[model samples]
Target: MITPDLSGKEFKLFQDFILENSGIFLDINREDSLRISLFSRITAKGFRDYYEYYSFLRYDALGEEEFKELLSLITINETYFFRNPSHFKFLKEYILTPLISERALYGKGIKIWSAGCSTGEEPYSMAITILEVFGFYKNLNIEILATDVSLKALDKAKKGIYSLHSLKLIDEKIKNKYFVPVDKNRFKLKDKVKEIVKFEYFNLIKEPYPLIEMGGWDIIFCRNVTIYFKIESIIRVIHNFYNSLKNDGYFFIGYAETLQQISSEFLPFKWNDIFIYKKEMRDLSLEEKDVNEKETGITEKKIERKSFNKAILSRGLYSKAMKFFEQKDFSQALRKVREVLEIDPQMAEAHFLAGKIHADSHRFVEAVESCQWAIQLVPLFLAAHFFLGVVYDKMGQPQEAINEFRKVIYIDGDFGLAYFNIARIYQLQGEDEKSLKEYTNAIKIFQKSSSEKALEFSEEITSELLIQTCRQNIERIKGFINKKNE
Candidate 1:
């Protein structure tokens, strides 16, 4: 349906409405997204233009429900398990494990909150990380809370259900340990893990401070939430976060966000490639600096800035390569990735991309070499390892392929493709039961509310069609089993 364009007045109306209700400023840049979002519903409800829709949203009896529906459409919920594995790596090796171990000695408590935890992936991933580190000995007092403004999102979080896309970054071990396959494409998080996380509906901008208790939180992950707010509101929210955090409590902001021009209540601590802020001993509300604060501390400023610039260049090239790869222009894609590699040879992501490009062209030896380089630089790189497995499979080294695939599963329990390949190996070996189990696992990962799009063969073989194929194979295997017994 062709939805009408939103006039300036109508756009202003929505901007004001969103700001007044949620403290989120929908500026000129967001007009297109707002227009598209409203258009989808406006046309469905037979409204002609943005003005009519605005009036209906403001005055109609069903305006409230319509507004809720609009919120669901407009909000960004693009998240996956352990979206940034580096941060998870930091959390485990540097921050969490030590803190928990020391606190365990004294039976102290830890409080962690995932602010704006869209569909609960962040918090659930956190729970899985903790489980990986601590195992079943849950002696220490721990409280984990997940909050989001969208009631619909919170409801999904509370239900603890997710698609394989959300679990794409997760390993098969974590999936097997913490999640039960609900069907083809959907997985339900285990009750033990789900019970540890408390999901609540709370708008950061509109809600009052201390939604759970009065401060003293050891860590608060408020990443990507404040980007929607106006500068004034962002300042207020950051202040609230600072006051809410206990002394030396950790505060994590998203990569695109900075405490720079807004607040100085926290000190930025540089982790490799990322920076997390720590609450200072002295209050800085009064001693706030007017200058835009640098993201990293001043000592390593030059090195970090140089590296950041290099990363920017490499990323721009890598992005072009991905676009080329997506369009099936493998040569140009390879060229772009090579440009990235020249600028930063140590870039594991670029190497991974080059490996994918080579693999797509069926140059298995080159693909293997590129993936090996990626593994050398970033050993836990799941994509590189998975692609290496694919390369080995194509090279007719079934055992070698199986070994690499198992490594991916070991790293991320929810990697269904690894299971799918393993099942294929079992089938080749005439192990019907093992093959059926693996195929069932893969099918369970792919069955979802919607069909997933194809991934150009780099990854993600789990789609509705693939799930059906797996089922057919399972049935065929069953037939073979029955005939053999007869």
Candidate 2:
């Protein structure tokens, strides 16, 4: 069974199909990966190409079975027990105690919905943590509904089998007590632990609460899963979760999944360095809303008639600086940047621009200082860190440059320049293997961004141009590696 390289059109069609059915956004860079997986299916069916395979899956009766196979390939079930222990720690110390007291007062059991509970580790882990913290599970009724879109994953989850990697973060005492060793490097969850979590095939985006009785849950653990969706789909899914929660009930999300950026339906509360959202309190009077907003730092004066003229002026100055910088007029750019800094001293972008202008004029010392200031103002500013790396690289500090590049990637994993520049640095240092790896990473990331039609970080740089350039660099590096070997 020969697996053909997928054409751009074919990849886009397949991407749309998957996203329409399940709210998973397969980035364009996954074309190669998808083609390989599709090949396995195509080979099994003796299909000629992806088009035929897609047709069969769309029209044929047995397409349902084939889709399950395809879904198992596409869906990333990369969760392990206690992956983010901070979340669990917050739940145990802050949430569970209140829940216990609240449940006692109400004479009711607590319900937890682990939306996208891939392979049961998360839900089961939650069950174990709860049992440990509560000290006697029999007294309190806790219903854990673990749901996933993939039937294959749900099946695996119900069996409760996991390898050593899944158990790596689990404490030895917890492991010995809650999980029994099944085979070498394999463990099966104890029945007592498994009984609490009921696994079901569920879709968060399309499916409304179809099966479960809507008794309202104390908490909903829908972490990490939302990252697979686009921002719009993410908003829809988060809204669905909002409706599912009881009033004032807590909703736990993974740190990586930025629901805050997508939706404002849930009220965010900081718990032990973990941000959990709650259903907005019902029937808050106007006064109460004002008080609530103020506590959250959105005060009356801060929100009402705030002067944007200064902000507008700062943006104008920044724009002028950028124009000058682009036109290779470093002195003029420096003047504009200074004007922006004078107006808004803490403007990270202005500081970053100043650094870039300084770098242009070979003022490495001033460049480094400006970049440091930018970083101090906004530590997670990707461009600032990236330029700082560039400044360091020019200043004969490879290690510092690499560190800043790494920091950029740490803040934003999708940053293409960081990957590409790091790869270039590695190539310069004769680290062929590392260079190739970073180059490949940059190519993959750029491919995805190209497919998305917008570049991340730099508004001016299109993903297509970046991808093409990265590809050329990759080829050059590869040729060099081959030549070096010869």
Candidate 3:
């Protein structure tokens, strides 16, 4: 009889299969979860051994259905009603208000897409946003298309049922108006809101985006969705999103995600505590064509951002200082940065570089102060944020570090280094699933920059580092599970 202890070879094959089919790029870290999920599949299929099941999946006509089920079982669908209140707040206060007010004048349709609408909460939440903003605009053609790859999830989405636990955080007024009690513990969505949203199954990696058929949506919420794929996958998906939006359409993402790595086709816009993107109209002229062609072929480049500037330092002195610092001479480096700063107090780059050195030396408090000063001088500088995040991480303040990293991506999405650090934090927090997603985001950007050298290094490191971490953790978790059984 076969058991769920997948062999190293079989596991690798299964991981590759997931990547090829779903663009989800799994590592050994997910092995325990995959084993559990896959065990259910095997047992349901009446398979005894791992090899037999593997062969069956490879040769059987039912493999595709089973594979889809595997994705459904392993995919993280931890969404709640009106989660991340800021995005919806922005939509209601800024986006929906303005769009509906404008539509009132033009008598046009309003369309939105919740691109990765897990369990239907996001789309339903968005529908509520429209209702709240427009109030009596029942005359307006307001439509929301909610899509996900899991048929099981989509099925639930269509039903629009939520447990009382999921509704606990919702405002009573919003809940009462939008959902009516169906039974002791169940609630059905009011017909008014139900008619506005249509749930459909979509694979961001495979199936054609249904948003195309729905026409140019006025807004799209694809937050935290792209953090799960390789660089090519991100590029493909982002471009598809760009194509699906109307001119000046808005895109919303998780606060932790940004379009800095994706493209400049979207312009950053901020509202009261909420951030979103507006699609910039493309210039299709020949000059624009040249730029486009250059962009199309331009590979992802390794970031070589200097956290600190050297111009403030006397060239000879700076070189000498760097040599000392490289030799682990923190005192000398600190003195050199001070000397340079005394000569040019506003030298943002120099302060940042000093912060980097301090951060590397584990002088986190000094690093934070220096980075904060550098940012004060040059707010758009990415080095300051990166250094600040590192300092926060060293101090064991992960949320602070996460905020700093989020700022880095906000200014520069293509910052593969920041993504790597963010992934590390998530991993350390026992959020391997989230870490895997972030690692994939970094990989996608590295791939796009066609940064073969850096990409090779990352692939080598993550394949060893993250894969091993996952395996070890999974083993630990399984041990605990087994002990519980006993």
Candidate 4:
């Protein structure tokens, strides 16, 4: 059965509804995604159109329950054990180790909240790491609270049964020790690991945070969760996470997600190559004190000042790096960029600059690594994608280069230079028809832009210059086609 197409009005209604209820922002680009998610329910309910389904979902007596069903369909649940090994490594070495010692002294338990925990991998992974670090769970006081809005995912998590694909990162010894194979491809987590993690259904945006009565969480893992939220929603959620954390407790977000513009309440800390935020320690007794209270007054100012100083220092170093890059001093540029990264590892632009410098110096391997780091830090980084494409092309990997260029176009449809590069690659591969099509695309995009507008990355090439070059390429490709016909 075909799913009815969602009209723009209906799409907006659903987008608004999702945002209001769950704080998930379905942008204009996600129209097809929204449609597909609602398709099953729309068809199942015998609704002929999207509007009818939306109406039923909004007005019917069981609408709330139905909405939960919709959420299950739409919510992203892609995860795996020990994802981003650096985070887990940091957890064991930096976070858990110190906490174990301190908590041991105080005879208190370690509390971890894995907010937006999908299918239990994260919290379970944490439990595994905790058990490994402490050598056993019997004498240790540890609490792992894993929560998600997706009831379906939580159900699966509770079952503690997983496919081999989900355990891809697990070592053989660890896998054998922590899991019992249920079948050829499935494994059930050992009772020891499962017992520690408590999976619950809690919406980050709508539901009140759990376990606050017990005390603030010692650590919170909400990685990759906030990317779906709007800026305002992210702020609200981060604020809640901040309040829900003990002073000096750590907060982990996805590598691609940064709190730079969102909030400065938490101090950004680097653990090896990975960056995590730390809730600065504060005096709880001074909580009710007025701003005029001298000791407490300076605390807020100190945090702001520290954040300001770091920003200034990183920016200054980045400026120097850019200047060196422009001056063709690759070594100096690389050095300065490294300094920028050392100060602010989350600076995606610095990583991109470092990648560019490496590429310029003909260090393709280093260049690729740096560009990848930049992309991992900021997934939608256009410059990094473009530069990575260029590096791949220089390394004689035409298909890889094309893939990166296509990503640039995907991220920004009007990136005429990406089209131009793709056309050039096709031309080199002796594919005249494909080259002509991409050249035409380049010309069309360039024509829509101001003639004087400089192309991204290739700032020396204006829209007019690119359009003229594309036209020449189109004519050359046509000549090749005509000769083949003859």
Q: Pick the candidate with the highest TM-score.
A: 4
Prediction 2 TM-score vs. true: 0.57
lDDT of 3 by residue, 1-486 (tens): 866588798789888777767777667788888889888878888888777777766788987777778778877777878888978866774457546645643667788889888888888888877766433334566778888877778888788888886676688877776787888888877766677889877778774666576558889898767677777877778888888888768888887776777777676755446667777654356676666558775321211011112221343355566677878887888788778777667656567768878877777888898899877776645556776887788799999999988887775565665677788788778675677677777666655422222223243563345444544555554575578779
Q: Quick one: how many clashes does candidate 3 have?
A: 16
For each candidate in turn, the TM-score is 0.54, 0.57, 0.55, 0.58
**After superposition, candidate 2 runs with Cα above 4 Å error:** 1-3, 46-48, 60-65, 210-215, 284-486
Residue-level lDDT tens digits of model 1 in 90-148: 67655565466455445676788898898999988888778665542245467888988
Q: Model 4, residue 423: what's the lDDT? A: 98
lDDT, ranked from best to worst: 4, 2, 1, 3
Pitting candidate 2 against candidate 4, the one with the higher TM-score is: 4
The TM-score that candidate 1 achieves is: 0.54
As a whole number from 0 to 100, the lDDT of residue 92 in candidate 1 is 64
Q: Report the Cα lDDT for residue 253, model 2.
A: 86
In model 2, residue pairs whose N, Cα or C atoms come closer than 3 Å (at least 3 residues apart or on different chains), thus clashing, are: none
Task: Give candidate 2's error at residue 381 in angstroms.
Answer: 50
Superior candidate under TM-score, 1 versus 3? 3
What would the per-residue lDDT of candidate 4 be over residues 45-118, giving only the tens digit for each residue?
77777777777778889887888888988899989999888899878755675466556546677899999999
Task: Tell me model 2's lDDT, rounded to 2 decimals.
Answer: 0.77
Name the better of 1 and 2 by lDDT.
2
Q: Please identify model 3 stretches exceeding 4 Å from their true place.
A: 48-62, 182-186, 213-215, 283-486
For candidate 2, the per-residue lDDT at 32 reads: 76
